[model samples]
Target chain A: MALRGRDIVSIRDLSTEEITEILDHARSMIPVAEGKKSSSALEGKVVATAFFEPSTRTRLSFEAAVQRLGGRCLTIADIGVTSMRKGESLYDTVRMLSSYSDAIVLRHPNEGAARLAADASDRPVINAGDGSNQHPTQALLDLMAMHETFGTLAGLKVVLLGDLKYGRTVHSLAIALAQFGSELVLSAPRALALPEDLRGELESLGAKISDEPELRRAVRDADVLYVTRIQKERFPDEGEYRSVAGSYRVDASVLDGAKPQLIVLHPLPRAGEVDPEVDRTPHAAYFRQAFLAVPVRMALLSSILAPTRGG
Target chain B: MVRELRITPIRNGTVIDHIANGLALDVLRIIGVRDLDKDSTVSIALHVRSGKIGWKDIVKVENMELSPRKVNAIALISPSATISIIRDHQVREKRAVDLPEHVTGVVRCPNINCISNQGEPIESDFRVVRRRPVVLRCAYCDRQVTDFLRHLA
Candidate 1:
């Protein structure tokens, strides 16, 4: 199917077949991104990334993806440094950015901000991250990583660790994971546990979900460990982040009794959660996970820009 | 049908039947119908046992046309409510009620910190995002307004 000029605001918008198509396209683009092959599909297309919030992986991965596809990127990293600080609304910023680029990737601290921007912009608006709401692209990339590691999601045992309450990535990923029959182990501090209604929804979708207090018990026999940082910025109080930060940490010693092929993943910007010593171990697939984002995003961009016939 | 037959007939007025008991006042409040005189025949039957549904209430207002807004408010209060609009001893309309898409100036967001709840004279606006579970997100605050604790305008 073609993906030209489509706004990827939520993973809920993609069916299982479309997600598989994106993964397939991403897998095909891996060789080209590694310099094994050459393709200039997005030659003259200009992609604009508007980050109103703090980001490193998402921004850089998008930039890399656009560049790898032979396209240019116009990035705005800080909202304060831009005209937004001088009394500009998000709608105005989107309208102005849309005129300059073929597609706009927006990351904002407000919930439903992407939808508002999408409504305003003539160009396609992809939601990079919205305030504790969704990060569709991250979910897509995580699915790609999981598919590459586990072969299929039919009966995979996946554990999502840390800050489920505030982590937009996990929320989006969990929603997407529900489409596939994946048993989930949600490990989080009591204060940062996943919302009850969402958990119920997942359970309704035939996902065998269990909440565990400790990270070790959650990841001991799990096929995948998806770790997220305790987002301090999302909390209105600093004490909340402080209280829940130490309870969930994955290190070399923690994985001593775990499965040999256990894939540990973290949506980066680590703050003493996962020990650096674990980076050398074959279990640490977070870096590869981060690198995997490029090709996935490339496929996403290509699908959005130059879709196949009858797509 | 037996529950409807239990309620006494009104000559020329609206009958809001099949409302859940103890919710009639809330329904009245939501529809902004508080100025009825004490002498006026405003009959309210509450906690009346009914077959199948266990218990329900019926309110018969004397000489009043049940507005669409009032019907919608009744629907929000009790989803299974039936509104019978009467005119000159004739049943004009009798059917199930439903709230409109853009419900303005009624049912304030319960969040105290919400802009609509700050007494700024702003209309309490909501769009029905999800119909099955009846999820209403505030137009101003974007907070999910559930059924249990909605503030009437």
Candidate 2:
């Protein structure tokens, strides 16, 4: 269960206790994150960031996490400049990256790219995001935020709204929350409903699930409403994307019937999923959700890079 | 004690009996019958009724003993198929094929952008997650595969 030298390819690879351990470490890193104090957990360690896909938030959070931990980082983005454009396979790139760093953080358009990288590399592989399959680190930070709000991850009435099918964060968070015994409410159009096999699996895990197509109806009794953007990039048809574009907007008016203590979280870079006016509400925790990524990621980097005593 | 057989039994080979009624040809494709030796005798019976499954198909291959990989593929397409290995006109080892926990190289991950599908040197591997619906999760992409016929590797 020790995260040291492990590949974080999926949230399923982590146990509930291991997840909580990382969160606890992240909480302790909050002071270091705010520059109130500093930790040299990765003073001499090197971490590599090889993002094959375009990103703003995830890449920045990882680079900042490495820097905060006093580790040297080498970033190579394949979106513009890399051998990946020259038809170099993920294995080749990952093999090369492993030679240069103690740990590698990877993001690819392919769903299982991190697993591929981890299988080939001796160094620890951290998945930033992989297609629409999983984002374990994101789920960890999201849980940390949930733990901050509710003081525990168990038994919260969690409503996951927006594009359930294509949102990687939604998939990982839903499964991880199920492992924590959260009551799950899924609200999405039929086109984007939770995959049935996954739903069946979650139900078998003793997590109660309810189908609520209307976002307002879904969040009325929610303790935590985790929203995700309906990614236009995932849909091939423009008209189909247009049809579901504004289907689940969360404004102050929409939250009128919601529980007063209900906290709303979103993996940011929202494309009109939440109203700007709602950003001023007490329920808006997306910004703090984003801020928590720094310390959480710092904890992850430190865990993987820190050397054990007796060496 | 026996009379003349309707179809002559093979001396040695595999007899796959009670295949789900219309999937004989599909099973042939999976086992690569076209690539078998020219001298081998292969017989297929379709729309056959049986006391067990009521409607079934049977395939008999002379001079070919199917590997575990082929048998595993048979389990996916026809969960109730029984593989009977005949030696010297006697049923030597007869057992019903059951799906293994992990199956590899049987079918491809349907996700087009899956790492297993990107011309990599990765053989498709699936973890048999559910049996009733025959759900398979790609070992690489975590994509659930239900349409097995479409994504046969």
The numbered model that scores best in DockQ is 2
lDDT of 2 by residue, B26-137 (tens): 8888878887889988899999879999999999999889888889888998899999999999999999999999999999888888999998767888999989768899
lDDT, candidate 2, at B17: 95
Model 1 clash count equals: 2
lDDT for position B128 in model 2: 94
TM-score of predicted structure 2: 0.93
What lDDT would each prediction earn against the true structure? 0.80, 0.89
Compose the digit string of candidate 2's lDDT tens values, residues A46-163.
8999888888888898988888878888998656688777888889888888999999999998889988899889999999999988999999999999999889989999999989
Give the TM-score of chain A, superposed on the true chain A, for all candidates in the order listed.
0.96, 0.97
Clashing residue pairs in candidate 1, if any? A1-A311, A2-A311
**Candidate 1, residue A288: CA error in Å?**
0.7
Candidate 1: deviation at residue B1, Å? 22
Off by over 4 Å in 1: A81-83, A307-311, B1-15, B33-55, B58-73, B86-89, B99-145, B151-153
- Writing each residue's lDDT as its tens digit, candidate 1 over A150-232 gives 88977788999989987889988998888888889988888988977568667877788888777778778899989898888
